[model samples]
Target: MRIAELSRTTGVSAATIKYYVRAGLLPPGERTHANQVDYGPAHARRLRLVRALIEIGGMSITDAARVLEVLDGGDLSTWQAVGKAQYALDLRRTAGPGGDPVARAAVDELLARRGWQVFEENPARATLVEVCATLRQLGHDDFVGALDEYAEAVERVAAVDVAVVARQPSVEQTVEYVIVGTVLGDTVLAALRRLAQEHLSRNAFG
Candidate 1:
């Protein structure tokens, strides 16, 4: 297929496709002549993957490029990429640097006390640590006090998630659910939180 046909089929602009080709995210098409080129199914699949990473996965171009590099290099597993992408999206959405050392240390100690094994490679763990650090720097000592309750809530949520996964009949479906949940679950929780807030505000004040 020509660039125009590829663009038409993929709903991506010709110029953008060219840019992707130049960036090596999409392999360059075969040169038919000095100014003409022809693409194939590989190009189409690459384009789709790129679109998913950028649109559904909410990755910036640079991050998408990095992910493409990993996919192309064949060194990292797809599950690892999925985890990395989820972490990147969460970090982007939750804006704020790590809090002071005092707060971070407090959170770390709390986690240690709870016997929660902190995985250095897990982005979610890093995010929790950062949030705790920020809360501590803000002089919110109550945040430290809330660790027990929060841990309980986390456990409850994890159990519920596990139950949901157990209902799936196959390992593939279970893994798929986990990957999709990592991204979509945050939205579900946010919506639920808003509803809870509305209910509290309406009844508690009255």
Candidate 2:
């Protein structure tokens, strides 16, 4: 198909498509003539993936480009693909609590107490510690106390997510499923939680 057809099929603007190609997020289409290009179904699929990373996942172009490099390389297992996506999305923020000994010990204790095996250099550890510090700063220690309970629930959800991705037939399919599930599922879960909270609030207060 031509660029106009590709644009129509994808609901993406021609200029935006060209920009993505130039940014190296998407590969250039075939050069059919001096002023014409042709795209294929693969291009269409790639465009959708690009859009999902940028629109749903909220990844910057640079991060998205890194992800595209991984996706383009292929041959990754489901675990590798999802892990690479997570790595790309990680902003590697400064350690929270600024290396407070108490916060650091608390984070270590929480992991040990939960029997969770997390890597020392994992970004999630720092993020969780930062959140704990913020909770203490805000006098919301009860929430921190309930962190274990939250982890228990999340572990169950994570197991289910793993099973869902495992059922996919191919790496590409699994990557797509994980990307959609992780990104859109967050919004869906949050919306559901708010709805449930509203219902309980009405029942308790009305």
What lDDT does the true structure give each of the candidates?
0.69, 0.80
lDDT of 2 at 4: 95
Q: What TM-score should be assigned to candidate 2?
A: 0.84
Off by over 4 Å in 1: 32-35, 75-99, 121-126, 137-206
Sliding window of 10 residues with minimal summed lDDT for model 1 = 70-79
RMSD of each: 5.2, 2.5
Deviating ranges (above 4 Å) for candidate 2: 91-98
CA RMSD (A), model 1: 5.2
User: Native-vs-model 1 lDDT?
Assistant: 0.69
**Against the hidden reference, what TM-scores do the models get?**
0.59, 0.84
lDDT of 1 by residue, 24-44 (tens): 778899999898899998799
Inter-residue clash pairs, candidate 1: none
